[model samples]
Target: MDKNKNHVSIWCIVSLTSIPLIMTLGNSMLIPVLPILEDKVGITSFQSSMIITSYSVAAIFLIPVAGYLSDRFGRKVVILPSLILALIGGLIAGFASWKMDDPYTMIIIGRIIQGIGAAGAMPIVLPLVGDLYQDDDEKISSTLGIIETSNTFGKVLSPILGSVFAAILWFLPFFSISALSLISIALIFFFVKVPKDKDEPLKFKQFIRNTKEVFKDEGRWLYTVFLNGVLVMLILFSMLFFLSENLEKVHDIKGIKKGFVLAIPLLLLCISSYISGRKIKGDLSRIKKIIVVSLIAMSISIVFVGYTSKKLILLLIVTSIVGIAIGALLPALDTIITDNIRKELRGTVSSFYSSARFIGVAAGPPIMSLVMKNYLNISYITAGILGLILLLFVFKFIKVDEIGKSKEPA
Candidate 1:
C-alpha cells in the first residue's frame, strides 16, 4: 500500500472503528447501574439482567441477517440505518425513564430495538474492514486489533461512565447512548468510504449454496473459531457482570469508586488486545499458539478468581490475568476466521461468528447471576473448565499451514 493510500485507509479505519466503541458503551454502560435500576424499578436481579440480555438477544438473532444484507446491499447502506435505529431506541428508553411511572417494560422494548440496530452496525464492521485491505493480512490483523481494542476500551469506560451518569440521574445513560450513536452515525457517513461491491451480488439461493460449500470445506477450524469466539465473550462479560455486582453488593462500593475498581481488569484487557492484535500478524502457528497458551492461563486464573473472591485484591489480580488471556485470544480468532474465508463470504461467515458471540454475551449475565446467587465458585469453576475444553479442542483440531492456510476438512 502506498503512503497516501495507507493514510486514507487509516482514516477510514478510525471512523469505522467508532461503531463498536459506541455500541459497547450503549450496552456495557448499564452494568454498574443495574443495581440502581432494580431499586428504582422494583425489579428482581434477573429482571435487571434482562436489561442487558434483551439487547444481546436481539443482536444474536439479527446479526447474521445484517451480515447477509450488508453483502447483498452495501455496508454503508446497512450501517447508516442501523445507527438511526439505535438512536431512536435510545430516545425511547430515555423518554420512558424520564416520564413513565412504570418504565421497565418500555426500557426493555427500547433495548430490543437498540439490539436490532446493533446487529447491523458492529457485526458488519469486521467484514467491512476486511473489504478495505483485501490483500494485506497484516494490515487487517492490526486494524481488527485496533477495532477490538476500541471495543475493550469501551468496556473500560463503561463502568465509570455508567456510574457517573446514573449518579446524576438514573436515566442519563440512555440519553447518553442516543447522543453517542448520533455522533457515530455522522462519523461513518462522512469518513468511512468502502470500496464499491465489484462481484455480482449472489442470489439468495446461490449465496446459500456457496455458504454451504465453504463450510463443508472448512467446517472444523471454522466451527472451532465460532465456539472459541462465543466462549471468550461469555467469560469476559460474565466475569464483568459478576465483578460489578460483587463490588457493589459485597464490598459496599458504588458509583464512580466502583467504576474505577471495575476499570482495572478491563484496562489490562484493552492493552493486551491491542498488543496481541498487532503481534499475531496473520501467522497461523502464532495464532494457534497464542490461543492455546491464553486459554490455559485463563483457565487457571478463573479458577483462582473463584477461590479468591473473599479477598478483593487477590480477586482483582486473578481477574486481570483472565483479562489478559481473553484479550490475547480474541484478535487471533478474528484473524483466523477472516483470513481463511473468501472475501465474498467474509460478511456472512464473520456474522455467524459475531452472532455466536452475542449468544455468549446474552447468556452470561443471567446465568452468572444465578450461579453467583447459589454458588459463586460454580461460576468461575465452570468458566475455567470451559476454557480447558476449548484448549483441548484447539490442540486436537486447529491445524494450519506455515503460511497460515487452513487444511481442508476430512
Candidate 2:
C-alpha cells in the first residue's frame, strides 16, 4: 500500500463521486427531455426510448469485458481511456441532439459510445476503491459505504439538477455530463494513485477462467441476488418512466413541472440513503433482512404507483416508498459485493454485477413501454412478478452470513 497516499482528498472523492454522477445524471436528466425528442423528432415511443436504451445496451454487452480489462491492465489505464470516451461520446450526442434534424439515430450511436465509456468507468470504480485502500479494512468498509451514498446521491440529485439545467436549456444536461466526465478524468490523473497490481499478466484464456472462478465461490450467489436487486431497481425506474410518460401524454405536463413530478420519488431516495449510511455497522443477517424488506417495499410501491395513476397523492406517496427502498438496497448490495469478493478479483466481479444491472436497465424500458402502450396494468403486474421472483431467489441463493469469512484480518 502507498502510505504516502492521502486517503481523504477532496479531489479523490470528487473523482470517485464523478463516476456515478456521470453514469446517473445523463439518464435522470434525459427523462424529462425524452418527451421533447418525441415531440420534435416525430419518433415512435420505442424509438424515443432508444436514446436511453442504447447506452445500457452497450453497457450490458461490454461492462464485463471492461471490468476484466481494468483488472488486468491497471485501474487507471482502463478508467482514463473510459473518461475520454465518455467526453467524446457526450460531446457528439450533445452536438447531434443540437444539430441533426433526424437526431435519434445519431444520438443512439453517440449513446452507445457513451455507454461503452461508462461501462469502463462504473463497474471499475468500486473495485478501484477496494484496490486503492487494500490494507485498511475499516477504511475500505467506510469508503464502500460512502461510494454507495454517492451513487444514490447521484440518482437523487441528478434529475433535479438536470431539471434545473434543462429549464435553462434542453441541451444543458449533455454538456453537464461531458463536463463531469472531464473532471473525473482530471481527478484520477492527479490525486488517486493506487499502485498497480503485480499479478501474472492476464491472458485471454485466463480471463475466461477467472470469470468462471467468481461464480464458484459460495458467496457469489449473494452477488447474483444483488444483480436481481438491481433488476428490481430497473423495474422501479421503468414504472417511473411509464408514469412520467403518462403524465405528459395523458395529463398534459411539459418541461420543468414535468421534471419535478418525476423527481419526487428521488427525494425519498435521498432521505433514505442518508439514513442507511448511518446504520452501516450492523451484522450481515440484519443487513440481508433490510435488503429483503426493502425489495418487498419497492415491489409494493411499484404496484401502488401503477394503480394510482389517477390519484396523484397516492402516486407520490408510493413513489417515495419506492425511492426509500432503492436508497437502502443499493448500498447494501455494494457492500455485499465488495466485502465478499477477493481484492484482486473485485473489479471483475463488480463488472459482472454491473453487466447484470445494465442488462436490466437496457431491457426494462422498451419492454415496459411496449406493455403500457397496449395494456398498462401488465406493466405493474410485471414489476410485481419480478419482485416476487427476486424474493424467491434471495431465499434460494444468497448466503449473506458466510460472506464475511472472506474478509482479510484487521
Candidate 3:
C-alpha cells in the first residue's frame, strides 16, 4: 500500500478529487435554482424538492450495489461509465425542460437517471481513497480531507453558479451538469491511475457474507457513522432549501444576491472541512472528540436557530456555525470508517455509508418543505434532538479498540 502511495501523482489526486466535486455539483447546484424551477415548470415547492430527492433516492438504493461492483471490477471502471451516464441524464433534463410544455415529469426522470449515475460515482471515491493509502492512517485522513474539502467547495460554488446559470436560463444549470461531468470524466480518464486489485474477486455471495460479518463486529461504529451521515446531509440540504425559499419569499432577496447569501455558510464549511481534515492526522481519539464536539455544536446551532428571532443576519451566523460543525466532523467520519475496514470490504461498507448520507439529502428539502408549510421551528428542534441522540451513541459504543488500530489491517 505504501508502495502505491509513492507513485501517486497530482493529476490522480485532482482527478479523484474531481469526482466528488462533480457529483456534488450535479446534485447541490440545483438547490439555489429550485425556486426558479418552481416558477418555470409551474411546480410546487414540494415538487421542486422532489427533483433533489429523486436523484438522491435513486442513488440511495444503488450505491451499495456500485460499491460491490467497484470492489470487483475496479473504481475507474465504475466511475468512467457513471460520469457518461450523468452527462446523458443532464442532457435529458435540460432538453426536456426546454421543449416540453410541462417538463416536470421528464425532468424528474432525468434526475433519476442522474441519481443512478451518482450512486455509482460518489460513494466509490471513499473506498478508492482508502485503497490508495491502505496502511497509512495519516495520509488517508489528510487526502480524504482534500477530497472532502473539494466536496464542500462544490457546495460553496453550487449556489452562485446555479444562480448564474439560472440567469442565463432556468434549465441551463442542468446542462452545466453535463459540462462538469465531461470535465471530470476527461480528468479521470487521462490522468488518474487507480491501483488494480490483485486479489481474486470475491463472489457475490461471499461479498454479502463479508459485509454481514463487518457489521457483526463493527456494527456499533458503523451504524453511528450511517446515522450521522443521514443527519448531516439532512441538516445541510434542509437549511439550503429553507434559505433559498426564505430569502426569496420573506426577505425579497433573489438572483445573485440570494446566491451569495446561500454561499456564505458553505464557504465557511469548505474552509473548515479542509482545516479539520488536515488537523486530525489519523488519531483515533482525536477523531472521536471531533465527532462528539461537532455533533454537540450542530445540535446547539440548530436549536439556537429554532428558538431565536428570525432576523436574516442571525440566521446566517447560526447557519454558518452549523456548516463549520459539519465540516469539522466529516473527515473524521470518513477516516474512522474507511481506515477501520479491510480493503476487500471497504468499498461495500463505504457505499452503505454513502447511501445513508444520501437518505438525508433525499429527505431534507422535502422534509423542510412539509414543515415550512406548517411550522419551521419544529424541524430544527427535531434535527437537534436527533444529533444529541447520535452523540450519546458515539460516546458509548464506538468500540475504538477494535476499530481504531493505527496502520494495521483489520
Candidate 4:
C-alpha cells in the first residue's frame, strides 16, 4: 500500500460503490417492469425482451474495450462519461415512453445506449479498487466486499423499487435510472480520487503482449477465478429465478409479499459478503476454505431444494444457505484476482473477470427457464455438478504464498 496515499473518505467509497449499485439497479429494475413496458408500448413480449437483451449484449461486448480504455486513460475518466451516457439513455427511454405513441423502437435504442455506457462503468471498478489499495489485500478485499454487497442489495431492492415507481407512473423507473446515475456522476466527480498513474504507459502492442503473457503464466489460477465468478453468479441467479417462479406459480405469492420472500436469501448474501470479507482479511488459505465450503453447501442445499421446493418454508431455508455460500465465496474470488494482478494490468484482467460475471448473470434466467420446464431434480443436480467442477480447480490450482507476496505474472 502507498504509505503516502491520502486517507480515503466515506464519500469516496460511496462514490465508487454507487457505480455498481446504480448499474445493477439500472438493469435489473427493468425486469419486473417488462410486463408494464409490453402493455404501455403496445409491443409484443418479444419486443419488450429486446429492451433487456439489447443492453446486456452491448455491455458484454464492450466491457473489454472499456477496461483497456481505463487502462490507457484513467478509471474516473471512463466512469464519469459512461455515467453521462447512461443518463442520456435513461432520459431517452423515459421520454419515448412518456410522450410517443410508438415508443418501442426508441426505448430499445436508449437501452442499447445505456448498455454501451454500462460496459465502461461498473466492470472497471474491481481494478480501480485494486489501484487504490495496492498491496493492501485486506482493504481491497473488504472494500470489494462492500461493493459486491451493494450490487446484491440492488438486486434485492429491484423488484420493490420497480413496483413502487411503476405504481405512481409506469415510466417512472426509466427516469429513476437517470436520477441514480446523476447522483453517482456527481459523487464521483466531487469525491473519488483515483491513484495517480506512475507506470510509463504501455504501447497498444506491448499492452496486448503484456496481457497475453499474464494469461500464459497465471492462466491456471486466473481462469479458475474467472470461472469462479461465472459459476457463482450463474448458480446464484438461476436459483433465485427458479425460486421466484416457484413462489408465484406454486405458492400464489405475488406483489410486495413475493418481493419480501425473495429478499430472505439475497439479504443472507449481503450479510455473508460483508462478514466473510472482514474475516478473510487477505488470507488466501482462508479464502480457499471459504470457497470450498460455499461451493459444497450451495450444491447440497440446492439439490435438497429439488426435493423440498414444494414446501415454501423449507425451500427458503435451503436456498438461503446457498445465498450465504455465494456471499462468502465471491469476495474470496475477488481477492485472489485483485491481490495477485499487477496494478498496470489490473484493469484489463479484471475486465475479463467482469465480463465472465456478466455472462453468468445473463445466462442464469434462460437456463433456469429451460431447466425448470423439464425434469427439475435432474437440473438441480446438473447445476451442482458445475459447482463441484469449480471446486476441483480451487483445490488444485488456487495456491498462493501464505507470507503475502504475490506471484505476479511477469
Most accurate candidate by lDDT: 3
Which candidate leads the pack in TM-score? Answer: 3
Ten-residue stretch with the least lDDT total in model 4: 401-410
lDDT measured at residue 256 in model 2 versus the true structure, 0 to 100: 69
* After superposition, candidate 2 runs with Cα above 4 Å error: 1-6, 135-137, 196-207, 219-223, 404-410
Better of 2 and 4 by TM-score: 4
The reply for model 1, stretches above 4 Å from the true place, is 1-7, 402-410
For model 4, the stretches where C-alpha displacement exceeds 4 angstroms are 1-3, 34-52, 100-105, 402-410
Question: What are the RMSDs of all candidates, in order?
Answer: 2.2, 2.8, 1.7, 2.6
lDDT of 4: 0.81
Instruction: Give a tens-digit lDDT track for model 4, residues 1-410.
Output: 44567357798899888998899888777666665676777875456556666777788788999999999999889999999999999999999989999988888899989988888999888888888776777888888888888887887787778767887898998999999999999999999888788777789998899888788777888888889888887777667667766877788876566767877888888888888878888787888889899889987777777787799999989888988988888788878777777877788888888888877776776666666766778978888888888889888877765212334543
**lDDT (Cα, tens digit) per residue for candidate 1, span 221-304:** 788888998888888888888898889878888989999999999999999999999999878889999999999999888887
| Count of residue pairs whose backbone atoms collide, per candidate | 0, 0, 0, 0
- Which lDDT tens digits does candidate 3 get at residues 1-410? 54555466888899988988988999899998998898888989999999999999999999999998999889889989998989999999999999999999999999999999999998898889888766777888999999999999999999999999999888999999999899999998999777667789888898788777778878888898999999999999998898899889878899988899999999999999999999989898899999999999999898766544358888899999999999998898998888888888888888999999999999999999998756788878888999999999998888667674322334
TM-score of each: 0.96, 0.91, 0.97, 0.91
Give lDDT per model, in order: 0.88, 0.73, 0.89, 0.81
